[model samples]
Target: MSIRSGLFKLLGLCLLAGVLVAGIMFPVVGAAGVISNQASETVESMSSSLADEPPPLVTTLTDREGKPFATLYEQYRIPTTSDQISEAMKWAIISVEDRRFYDHHGVDWKGTLRAAISNSSGGDMQGASTLTQQYVKNYLINVTYRGDELGQQKAQEASLARKLKEARIAIQLETKMTKEEILTGYLNVVEFSRQIYGVGAAAQAYFGTTAAELNVPQSALLAAMVNNPAVLDPWNNPEKAKERRNFVLDKMVENRKLAKEDAEKFKEEPLGVLPGGPDKPASTCVSADPAFGFFCQYVEDHLVEDLGMDKDDLYTGGYVIRTTMDRKATLEAKKAAEEEVRKDEPNVANTLSVIKPGKDSHEVVALVANKDYGTDSAAGQTVYGLPYEVFNVTGAGSSFKIFTAAAAMEQKKYGIFDTVPVPNFHVSPVFNWGGEHCPTRPSGVRTYCVSNASDGADTSMSLQDALAKSPNTTFVILEEETGMGPVVEMASKLGLRKTMASRPADGRQPDPDHEKPEYSMSQKEFYGPNELAPNGRGMFTLGASPVSGLELANVAATIMSGGVWCSPTPVLEVNDRAGKPFPVKEPECEQVVPEELANTLAVGLSKDTQPGGTAASAAAAAGWDRPMIGKTGTTQFQGSAAFVGATPQLAAAAMVFRPDIPYGGLSYGGPGNVHATANGNMFGGMTPAQTWFRAMKPIMADLPPEPLPQPDPAYTKMR
Candidate 1:
């Protein structure tokens, strides 16, 4: 109990006091640091949400008469608002993931509070981070949640400092931008599925259209993506996606975002994924012919370049392109072709490809044998949508006439009536059917003998009569008269290119980087100097090269109608950002061929269908019952049958299908499958002609009938 004892005790008390004060200050400073870090990171993360990357423009296509056949869209990119965002899609994200998006800034204080309470309640997991904060961690902040099974959730939870940062950003965003902007930013950043990030992209991935174009069902389906993008991708997950979709609909109904009628309609609608995965690659078109699809894609590619516009701007930028198409003539040609398809013979397949003179736009109406569109193995397997954005077909057979005749006429080798004298015995350096020789016949005598290839002999006929009958001997002589070089040049002028995508020959392995290179050696063959495509050769006229049905139709259209090949037009007018539509400039048509020559050739070809002509059967189907104009050619691969004609107020062509029935194989098609139509007797005159008739009936009904033009008397034949 001395003074020393007292001093030591006091010193101990003082040391204890200092330790307690330091502990209090340490916690306060750490809390302050947490708050400051949170505030700074908040705005940076939200910035990534609304950033816009220029999307590829959609390439819209039109028919021969400048009507939209299909809408080629990229991003299905519709500039949408929160209101425009389907209630279904929005709910899918909110209910399953973050429910307080509307109530909070980028940071969810209430959610965090609830999560803290849940932790106190002894829950295994906790969630309070807002969608904006999550988006920031996933995108702008470099995706930190990618560790354990629940690593993302835990990592996201651990980012309160990150949450605080996003929260600060959300407040700034709300003040600097708008609710709509915030929503758009959120939508653009939200990952819905494989490689799909924005709502606009999601719309196309699910519905094959834009966000604005999505129906309730499609929207609901798309909304489900936010729940578990990879898991509930709708296309990959049916039941889960449906359940998720239904959940959204129920929420919307509960929230009154959609009427009961609309909700019910959506519930009843089917959910089907596009055959080609979500975002359609550029140049993809659903066509009756993949070959034809390639052509459509090619034209679209050139269109963007020729028009000098960004694809995104060209299609969605809302610009209108005008074309040079004669709807009247296009309909007529389409009708004539389908009339032949109606017969539906096993050997004879039918289709009509048409284009206006000088117009890049074209009309392609094909009469497919089946509606499946998936495979050709089935007996009645036909293609579904002619106007779909992705389709391809191998143009075969009688279609060769377009190039053959074009070559002959363009090179001035033969006039419409020039008597080229169908040879009875046409043996030449060219490889004929079965590698025999050209001019099937040895004698050069003149007679309208359709196809003497079987007899290895031929008769002679005038050029007009030969073309009308599609006689092999007649054309063989013409090929001789017109060298391959000039013939190829004329074919190009007619818009025919020789490279194709598959099946070798015309269908070779297509280069993914370049669209026009179907054939490996194409660039060396024809096209311009160092271009990808084959020039015409003596053997090239017999459908050896690849041309689309639509291209063929365009070629015939140029000739049948007074040669007006103007640029194709899909939209009638371009609209400004304000929704005001302005008419686009109309294109001009060119005189690709002499009107008199087109008329004369058309006149003479009519006779081929009259009797024993190659396409005579096709002609008979159009109510002619006997005489008409057409051309038919059979390949080792497939049969070629077509009938191109010009009636009063209508000028068109049609071809039919010969599904599975091979030539030079077991079924030769002589006894039955002559025209590849529905029935054995189906020919160009049958099914295609009948389909043509049916289509023409309605189109021509509204217009006054125009007289058929007379052929030029001075024109000579190629007999």
Candidate 2:
């Protein structure tokens, strides 16, 4: 023999001796409770343990009616059974990866010996790993290094130790599983491409076909990609991919799985990879359909925040989530908001929320916004949902007057019939206490002006009539007499503050004196203590507090239910992979006000929908024959228009505003324009009332009608 050949032989013998010594020294406990010095024995222990543990599966999300709307996954993989895999795919993989797969035990001693000889002689090193060993390596990499970049690198390090461990594990795996079972498991767990795993996902991603439908050429291409996915990506590197595919085809023919003529024919054929990108599955609410995106996000938030579920499990644990979304109601709400709001005025936004009213009413039937529920790059807006009750909060305008009325009756200080002077404008002592805007005149009395929308002549009207007219002067006088403490408490008792800022103790509105250079703070911050101190403001009763649309809806629902407030819930049920039921929260009901007082307030507020009421036009537009109670509200300079209405069966709230424009008293103009009002000013009775009417008309059309509870005789007697 030549000197180089002799040296290589000696080196190979030394390496074999070293491997034997290591195996004897590292004897491991094997199956059947037997201790063995064989290298396979150590592998048996580790492989069995690893094979029993699998990675987390994908989670599913469904709507109320059990229709799947979205899916969440870390790696988009759907496992397939052996029977579902094509024979072409199976032969293609086995021929290229392990021609002797069924002929040998997992270790492949002959191949290993040949590889050792070639490597020692400095010849082109050949891989001796069998299919089982490759599977073992992949399994180890996934279990040990998932979500860790550095750990994955280390697990894939081309070292003697890693190879030895893989060999041992492969040998043991062969003992536990049949060849077909191992092949199926291997195909299910292997990574195909970026964010894509398993043969099922790969087949669909590459050809838009299932595993069982993959033809011979397609199967050969996929099998070739297994060796070097990045380099052999058919779409990116067609030349290298074609070469690899032809190699796999030749191997199949060499192994007698395919005829020589067929192999040659496939080689001449074009790499007919269909034109498409990877099939990346939706993993979050942002990727959901526009109609369901907002509701999906709400459900995800509830799962993570309220229920304290792990976010990782939410994306991967395969838990089935079912939400309380009524598809028809949700679509109608969206349609109403979109149709009622002027599409030409891109700046204008409208939001609507609907909820059932009863002790067991926990589901938020519909929550819709005018804007699409995703990023609007052209408009420079990230969040697309309106100021929803739980996520975003904003001003409610005169819609809050119902709370003031509830407080008055709850305190027994004033009944719904209590009279107050309705004037075009009025001034108060507390208004002059804070600023120089209300200076003392020659009469020696400081005056704060409060104006009504109608600019009507001085007249005294019952509290019920004042509420229907939404006169600022009357509510201010009533608030002064009843005190702001009771009004704030009444709002809290309902669900106004549940998802928003609690009422400040001092009851102060934004101060005009401490003017900041930037006026970009949210409407909630303007009414919150951030911009204002805790002292009573004259305009407190005129709906200065910021509230969410859902908050207003919940308040209306509470009144509809005659005092009982049911905390809003979004999800109805959750299930595991095996369809086993999981615990779901029930509606939490509390009596926040007396039934008599609630009924009295509901009856008084219903006057707003009367022929002469502020929202009369909206009621006329809705054209409903059922009994309905509602209130209209408009903020200072018409910054926001709002309406809260309810029937005995359902309650809803709608609001229209321009969030992009700061709350510096900008008015929402009439149809087709946002900065200019055709009627000279925007009111709750215009856009918001119209939105509420259109949305509620369809939603309540099919529901059974129930009469509003009659006011207490004692309270009605005072009128």
Candidate with top lDDT is 2
- Tens-place lDDT digits, model 2, residues 152-209: 7755665556656666677778878889988887787777767667788889888888
lDDT of 1 by residue, 25-113 (tens): 22324877676455445344445343433223344455445665444543343346676666555655555456666776555655655
Candidate 2, number of clashes: 4
Each model's TM-score, in the order given?
Answer: 0.58, 0.83
162 Cα displacement, candidate 2 (Å): 3.3
* Best model per TM-score: 2
Q: What lDDT would each prediction earn against the true structure?
A: 0.48, 0.72
As a whole number from 0 to 100, the lDDT of residue 609 in candidate 1 is 53
